[model samples]
Target: MLLTERLMAGERVFSAWSSVPDSLNAEGLAATPFDAVCLDMQHGAHHEDSVMRCLGPIIASGKPGLVRVPVDRFDMAARALDFGAQAVIAPMVNSVADARAFAQSMKYPPVGKRSWGPHLAMGRSGFSGPQSAWLDEANRKTLAFAMIETREALDAVDEILAVAGIDGVFVGPSDFSIALTDGKAVDPSLESMMEAIAHISARAQAVGKHAGIYVVDPKLVQRYSAMGYRLFALGNEQNYMERGAAALLADAGALTS
Candidate 1:
């Protein structure tokens, strides 16, 4: 099922964010039980060419692929979609205009201005149906997530969520915490930031739109889930690799006993 379908069906989504920019890693992660594979194009090591390469493996793995496109770059979002990304999570969408632009880039005509050119995406995504059928389904199947990171976005959450064609509001908690405190590193302990997160989730839920968030630990997932966040981007492979290697080393040390 498409990521949008899962979200609409009220299923909790667990996604892995691939900041490593390696196709092999992307493929491996996508093959897991995670609902989606999100390639990071904003802060991660992926450029256009790399993301294109990563898409092939992700598609072959049969998991929905998402790209966290560079901030407000509608063209980049369009490219990601055209390259087989089932969804595009646009970072730092601070206003309704930002949400509209992001939505327009993801949807086709009559809904938005995204041009028809799923060159590699058509085959990569395994769409053997008629072109018209694909077009008809694309808009609804394609998810657009607006990242609410800054203080401005938190204040305008209602308007952003109200924008037509916006699938969800993705909370960048780290940046949100920083924005709340004016240039400090993300400190989740702050009561104000916690309140902002609650308000953001509440606003999205109020409108029947999904609320998503980034989490480094599994324990936090339950906490955010209780607050109505259904979509989660767990930590990337780099962190996983480190943790895995540490566990293996500890096991080796204990094996001598």
Candidate 2:
């Protein structure tokens, strides 16, 4: 099913956000029950080559592959979609213009100026019938999310959400905390910060758009889930590995050594 369809159905999407630029790691994570596997390129160690390498395993595992591009590179955004990404997570979208551009890049003409070239997306989407119809179908199905991380974005939340073709918004909690506190420690638990996050979600819902958040802590997942967050990024591969290793070592009595 299309990610947007699932989101619109009120399904809670738990995504595995990957920082490690290894196809092996992506394959393993994709094999899990997580709804999606998003390869982080903005801050994580991923470039075009690594993303191409990682896409194969993600596709093979039968999980949707998402790419958080470095910036509002429409060409790269379009390329990522062509390369079989089910969605494009554009970061640092602090204005309506940014959101519009990102959304445009993800869509085709009339909706946006995404050039016609779906080498991988064509086969991956399983539509070998007709190009024109497939383009329309792809335009409707492919998701595009703008990262609401800056104070400017928070101020213009409604306008950004109003932009056509933007499926939803993702909250970058750490950056949001910093933006809220003006360079203070990143604290998602601060009353003011929590209120701001909740306000973002509430505003999105008011306009029929979905709201999501990047959260590593399970407790934060529960907290945000209660606050009506439909999308949750459950940390990265390294974080999972460290947590699992720590638990195993502690259980084996190796931590006391």
Candidate 3:
């Protein structure tokens, strides 16, 4: 099923994404956690080959597999789908035009301009013949998510959500912190920022679309979820590993002593 469907079904998704270069670790990490795991090709060192490997366990886990392409390029998005990525989170989409281009690239001609072929998605080397009929279904099944990071995007939240094929909007406040936060933990600016995010999220809900956020700490993560964030990217991959490893060691040491 599409990740959006899972989210709309009221699934509180926990996506364990891989930040390191190794796809095996990415795949392994996804197999053990939440509903789905994203192989982060945008910020991580995970190349095409490694990413394919990382997807192994995620798909094996019976959970959906997601790929966060590093940039806003159609080629990257297209490549991700070719590798059997069930969905893609395109980083830094700031406008309605940008969203439309992404949708076109993601879908077939009628719905999108994505070139027809079953690269790795269907175990085919490539397009050996014309496949006009199947492209729409293929495009319809895959998901597209836009990152809401820029102040400009904040103003265009409603329009972005209104884009026909866009599945979800993820608030990336760490990168666009000012618009989403006034100061630090208790900054007054946070109230307005929070309100804005809540507004966008609410608008999304009103339209039957998903609202989401990428938060660093556990408290904030849960906080946003409680406020109705259905699809949340918990945090960066490195932080997850470091804290987990340290906690494991500390626990082991305490147990031994």
Candidate 4:
């Protein structure tokens, strides 16, 4: 099912968003936990080949997956979707036009003019099966998440939300912090940013759309949930892995009495 479908049903989706460029670990991680995986093709070491490699495992894992491409480029968007990603989360979506284009590039034919072909939507071209038809339904099934990452995006969140056909908005706090600080860390400025995000959530709820967010501080997850955040990318794979390993080692050292 498309992410939008699940979100519309009022399911609080938990996704793992990451910048791990290695396909092996990415696929393994996707298969392990998470309702979906948003491969970090943006600001990560992943190239087109890497994206393909990472996605290969995700498809085989029986998990729904999405990718965050570097920019709003249609080719990148089209390819990411072609690779069987249930969705594509675009970065720096700050306007209604950008959101429209993001949605336009994601669909096919009347939905969007994406060059049609069977690459990974099915195992092969001209290969039609009940499951294969599932891929064809992608035009209707695929999702498009426009990231709310900048101050500009916050300002236009309501207008952007008014755009029809957009599945949801993903909040990128790091970049959002940058936008708030003009390039600094998240702090007091975050209060207003949080308010802006909350406002977006309310608007989404009003219009029956979805609102996704990245949760860095685990403490904030439930708080945001109370404010109506539906899709939560709890944290990147690297964040948890690093913290877990470090904590284990620290505990081991402390036991050396």
Candidate 5:
């Protein structure tokens, strides 16, 4: 099922965040149990070429591929879709205008102004049908998630969610915590930060829109789920490797000792 469909069905889904710019690494991530794989271009090392290249493995692995485009890179938003990303998460969308620009880049005409050039998308999805068929389903199938990371964005959450073609909102908790503390520190678990996150989720839920978040601690998954966050980006390639290696070394040490 598409990530959008799963979320719309009220199923909690987790996506493995990919920071490395290698297709092999992406394939490794896709083969895991995560429901989806999101290539991060905001702080990660993924460039346009790497995103295009890595998506091939993600598609072959039969997992939905998503892209977190760089801050304010609306052009990359459309390109990521064209390159076969099922969804594009735009970072730092602080107002209605930012949300509208993101939506314009994500959806086709009438909804937005995204030009028609989903050649790779069609092939990746294996839809060898009429263009109209694909066009008809594109808007619904392709999701656009606006990031709510700043005070301005959190304040305008309702208005941003009201914008057409915006399928959901993603909470960048670390940045949000920093913003909340006036650049003092990054802490996703602050009581005030959690309260704000709950508000964002409640607003999205009231509108029947989806809500996603980056979960730094696995133990907090249930808590975030309770707050109505159906989608989660949990850990990156490095985290996986470190955890796996630590487990293997611990087992070896036990055996030897």
Candidate 6:
């Protein structure tokens, strides 16, 4: 099923966050148990060429490919879709206008101004029948998620969610923490931040939209799950490798000792 369909069906989807721009790294993550895979371009090393190259392996792995485009990079969002990404997450969407611009780059005319060019998307989605059929399903199949990381964004969450072609909202908890604390700290698990996080989730749910979050710690998954966040972008490729190596070394040391 498409990522949008799964979220709409109320399923909790965990996606692996890929920071490395290598297609091999993306392929490795896509082959894992993650329901989806996202290429991080905002803070990661993913450039336009890499995003285009990396998404192919992800799609070939039979998992949905997603992209977290850099802040205000609406054009990359559309390009990612054309490159076969099922969804695009726009970071730092702080107002209704930001949401509208991001949405405009994601969907076609009437809904938005996204030009027709699903070069890789058509084959990846197995739509070899007709162009009209693809066009008809494109808007619903592709998802656009606006990141709510600032006070301005949190305040305008309702209005952003109401915007057409905006399928959902994603919380950048790390940045949100800084914004919440007025640049004093970068703690995502602050007790004070819980209310705001819960409020975001509640608001999205109230309007029948999907809610997502970037989870730094895996243990907090269940806590956020209870707060109504169905989509989660977990740690990146480096974190996974470091954690796996640590666990393996620890087991070997214990056995040798």
The per-model lDDT (C-alpha) reads 0.86, 0.85, 0.72, 0.76, 0.94, 0.92
Record all residue pairs in model 4 with backbone atoms less than 3 Å apart, i.e. clashing: none
lDDT at 238, model 4: 72
Q: Work out how many backbone clashes candidate 3 has.
A: 5
Candidate 2 residue lDDT tens string, 1-257: 76788888988989999988998988898988898899999999988988888987887777788899997676778888888898888889999999889988988878888888897877765667888788768877788889999899999999999988888899998888888889977875556788888888998889888898888567887778777889888878778889989999999999985
User: Which residue pairs overlap in candidate 5's backbone?
Assistant: none
What TM-score does prediction 1 earn?
A: 0.94
lDDT of model number 6: 0.92
Q: Point to the candidate with the largest lDDT.
A: 5
Question: Which candidate would rank higher by lDDT, 1 or 6?
Answer: 6
Q: Please give each candidate's TM-score.
A: 0.94, 0.95, 0.84, 0.86, 0.97, 0.97
Scored by Cα lDDT, where does model 4 land?
0.76
Our tally of clashes for model 5 stands at 0
The local lDDT score (0 to 100) that residue 36 gets in candidate 2 is 88
lDDT of 5 by residue, 1-257 (tens): 88888998999999999999999999989999999999999999999999999999999888999999999999999999999999999999999999999999999989999999999988988889999999999999999999999999999999999999999999998999999999999987777788889999999999999999999888999999999999999988889889988889998885344
Number of clashing residue pairs in every model?
A: 0, 0, 5, 0, 0, 0
Off by over 4 Å in 6: 254-257
Q: How far is candidate 2 from the true structure (C-alpha RMSD, Å)?
A: 1.5
Which of candidates 2 and 4 is the stronger one according to TM-score? 2
Q: Which residue pairs clash in candidate 1? A: none
Please give the range of 10 consecutive residues that has the lowest summed lDDT in model 1. 184-193
Best-first order by TM-score: 5, 6, 2, 1, 4, 3
Least accurate 10 contiguous residues by lDDT in model 6: 248-257
